[model samples]
Target: MAKATIKQVAAEAGVSTATISRVLNSSGYVSREVKQRVMAAVTKLHYQPNAIARSLKQDKSFTIGVVLPDISNPFFMTICRGIEDIVQEQGYHLLFCSSDEKPEKEEQLLHLMVEKRVDAIVLATTGGNEELITRLAASGVCFILVDRRLELELSESGAVVDLVAEDDVYGAYELTKQLILAGHSVIGVINGCMGVSTGQDRFVGYLKAIHEAGLEHDPALLYDGHFTEAGGRAAVRYFLQMAKPPSALLSFNNKMTFGALVELTESGRDIPGDIAIASYGEIEAARLLKHSGIMYVDQKPYDLGIKAGQTVLHRLEKGLDKSLDRDAASPEPEPIRDILQPALKTLPS
Candidate 1:
């Protein structure tokens, strides 16, 4: 059987094709009664609106592009769920892409989003590509930053566009403080690569905690891990063989934490007995640990995702007004940045 068209639906509802189209798109003005009739006809015919035809007519795909650093990361999945919830309500689809922490891949995905004419883009960008992001913002493509911030050209008009991130430094500071209170004098840190803001901020937090606690911050205890399980395991091995092995170990991210656990288990080392282990983020690995007093910080992934979606919708509804300076008292709705606090959780001993 031939699929029902907008014209057919309109005829069934005793209205014009334009009216049916308006009701379908949920754009422009249509009376409540007319909307009900159109919807009734739609249900009766089981008619589906052609997204392509609608896009051509309205010059909108009703699609939002979500470019993530790594889809395999469970944290990103939580954020994706939040984005999905908001976009679905508006009948918009998500064009999801993972850059896998590769700068070139990120660049390609951004270009594709522009080419596809996505309504907006929410990206977790690598430290590279400030110029491309700046250009996107200048061209009026709604862009928002999540998880990672553009370190360079951040002050460049429209470079960041919008931002939603955790208080990385603070979370790290809090985590480090907890270790100190546990009487850990010599602490080892498995840090993420220093290219991203998260890594740098975390290192800063670790430094602050060390200084405030009046403990010597030994550079030897620090190891730059690529935020992976392998890196965590390697750091553990490096620290264990040190002249004075650290009494406590801090893993910067979940992947590193995973490695730390595996190494401890395989090497027949007891956690919280021989070496106390802690990390930045909470996951099943942290939850299942035998040590009841394990400490970590939660970045509130779901909230960050929801805020990212809200930021884009606000930009869409109110339009991007870059003319308004943030320094001003009554600034226009320029690029909004939301930084949420990370919650600290300590498992009972």
Candidate 2:
């Protein structure tokens, strides 16, 4: 079977190729009667527009690229859903790639997105490639940093980029404070890698709570879980080996929380009995278990995605298209810093 062409559709519809193009692109207005005729012809011929040719002609790809640290994580998946809900209405497609928390992989993915001529990129950076990110943004690449960000402000580096994330510092502080208020003087922290902004901010928040409580900082209680399930299990084992273990525990993310729970259960430690456990993010499985009693901060991943989507759309509408060369003298718009507040949920034991 042969693929149908625009010319064939136009001929069948008894309309010029220009009219067919206008109708297909929904550009110039065509009469209602003509539109129906053209659509009918399109259906009969099964004509499909060449995406590459259309993008080249219009200077727009109608595609958004997304690079996430871990695509398998439900947290990131919710964010992707939010972004897709917004962009899909405007006839834009998403190209998703996971960097797997590796800098080299992230760098390669970023370059691939540019080569594919994506209209915009939503990234959960692995805290590497700040220089390259800055350079690309400066060169008129539309970037929205979601969940994680660089060390230095991109605007300060002369690269305007939008950010949509939760208030990690405050959320972690409040979560830690909850454990402190529950009368846990000695608390253990299953922390993530301190390389990314999220990891750093969350740790800072935990420290602030400890400082305010006048509790002596025990370096032994801190375990770097590296935001992985295996790391979480190892951290639990490390804490168990300590001569004076913490009465309470805090896991920074859902994955680590899960690992901690599994390790504790297998080791015959009762929750809220032997040790109270809190988390920076909610664990979905905890809800199914009776007497879970897990205190957590709800980071609205989907809402963060919505904000990122809205920001990118607004930038594109404001003539921040990657196809156009930005004028040097033109003042750049202030970078968007949208930080959503997290909710603390403390369930009864």
Candidate 3:
């Protein structure tokens, strides 16, 4: 038996090969009547498109590309879960990739997604790839910036295709403010690599809180981390070795917290006894602290994902609804930078 071809399907559907091509490639415009005919013909012929050939003709692969900084990060994993939920339900496949927080890697992935002609792309941006995103948008492929704000233009353009993120500055500021109010004068900060948006924002928030409290930044107590256990461990050691160590510490994420805990334990330090600790996110070990129930923000990756999925689906449906034509008044929903508030828990002092 011979393999089915576009020609065969085109003939069966009573449409030109070009019309079938448009429907298949998801490129250009095709009248609904013709699109349906092509689809029917495709079904009738039981045609299976050659992966390479189909990609060439339709310029689309019916898949959503998800790019994250670090897949291992719990926060990102939660976001991935959210993205996967919607992509799977919508019958679209996901092409998940990690940039490892590198700009070059992010650029490479963006190029690949464009080349593969994914239906759309969801990115936790590395900030340096704004031009790449802009160029992709110019090419008419839908892309959303997740986790990080791309730029002022991307946020305001309403051309962003999609957006879902947190109110990082405010959340971080509030978190740090709590530590100050707890009466810790010398506070040590464990910051994630400052290259990313979340890292920078959180750092800013920490500074804002300290400044508001009339505290000056101390170089001896500030340590930048890789947002992992190793980085956390390193920061803990750095702070402890200082002649005048901070009376309390704050970590940027859960992984860092884990490392910080390991170091503190090895050094025979007691939580809130020798020093107090605060972290940005939840970790299992946090409960072992003087107060486990409170402290750290609940970023809510699951909820964020659910909302992001719904947002993308709404956009997709709007695109598919003939009545909601390209010119229709359904303004692309406002870019949602969903900044969730962090909950504070206390350790037994």
Candidate 4:
């Protein structure tokens, strides 16, 4: 059987080849009705574009590299799905890697992505390779920083780095404030690494609420959970051994929340009865465990992923502009920082 071509697809869709190109490449504006028609025709004919030929003509690999801290985390997985959905429409492939929250591992994976010559990268950085990331972006590698931001001044190098992340400080403040409103004086905090941006911002928020509520600064109530299940469990164990155990607990992320829950259950403690709990992020399992009155801030990971994908597409489009004379008086394109607000969810008593 002969392979279907673009010409046939355009003819079947009742549109010009240019229109077909625009739709297939996801480059220009095309009406939803026309897009649907073109897609239907392509599907009916089982049309497949020659990726090698396209790559050669365009000088693009049509591949996007994605690096996240933990692949096992459902939050990251949802983000990946959003990115895949967006890039796939533009005929781009994804090369995914997990850094395991290690800066060394993240650097290695990033180097590998550069070696692979991916057209762009979406990274949830481990927050330790600021220089390397800045250099790569300065070298004209399109990057969309997802869920985390680098502290270095990338704008100085004229590097195009876009950031799409939730308002971590605000979310943490709201979550912690919810516990405070519930009349908890000693609130235990299961925190992630203090070095990371999210961790630092969340800790700031927690402290802000604590101070605003006139709670004393108790160093012993804070436990570093490192954003892991084990860390969460260890924090609970430590809290239990404290001379004055906290009546309420606040976990920084979903993984730590799970860990804390497990520890509490094993210790024969009733959730929200003996000890109240709140989390900075949602636990997917809570939906299954009906009536689990866990107060949490819904970070909307899937939506965040979608926004990141859109940002990547926008950056790639801008990068394709050959008309701009860089050495001329054209001003540098400012880096985009998109901060999304997460909703605080409180269950009814």
Best by lDDT: 2
Please report, as a residue range, the 10-residue window in candidate 2 with the lowest summed lDDT: 319-328
Model 4 TM-score, all chains together: 0.83
Kindly give the number of clashing pairs for every candidate. Answer: 0, 0, 10, 0
> What lDDT would each prediction earn against the true structure?
0.84, 0.88, 0.77, 0.87
Model 4 weakest lDDT span, ten residues long: 320-329
Pairs clashing within candidate 1: none
Model 2, position 207, has a per-residue lDDT of 92
Residue 323, model 3: Cα distance from true site in angstroms:
14
TM-scores of the candidates in the order shown: 0.83, 0.90, 0.78, 0.83
Task: Give per-residue CA lDDT, model 2, range 1-349, as digits (tens).
Answer: 8999888999999999999999987899999999999999999988899888888888789999999998988999999999999988888889998998898999999999999889999999997798899999888899999998777666555677888999899999999998989889989999998889889999999999989999777888899998888878898899988888888889998889989988988999988788888998888877765676789998898898889899889888885533447677766678888989899997667
Q: How close is candidate 1 to the true structure, as a TM-score?
A: 0.83
RMSD of each: 4.4, 2.5, 6.2, 6.4
| Deviation from native of the Cα of residue 319 in model 4, angstroms | 1.0
The sequence of per-residue lDDT tens digits that candidate 1 reaches over residues 203-250 is: 999999989988877788899878777898999899989888999999
lDDT per residue as tens, model 4, 264-297: 8889887777788898888766555435578999
Off by over 4 Å in 3: 1-60, 154-161, 288-294, 320-337, 347-349
- Report the C-alpha displacement of residue 233, candidate 3, in angstroms: 1.1
Candidates, ranked, lDDT: 2, 4, 1, 3
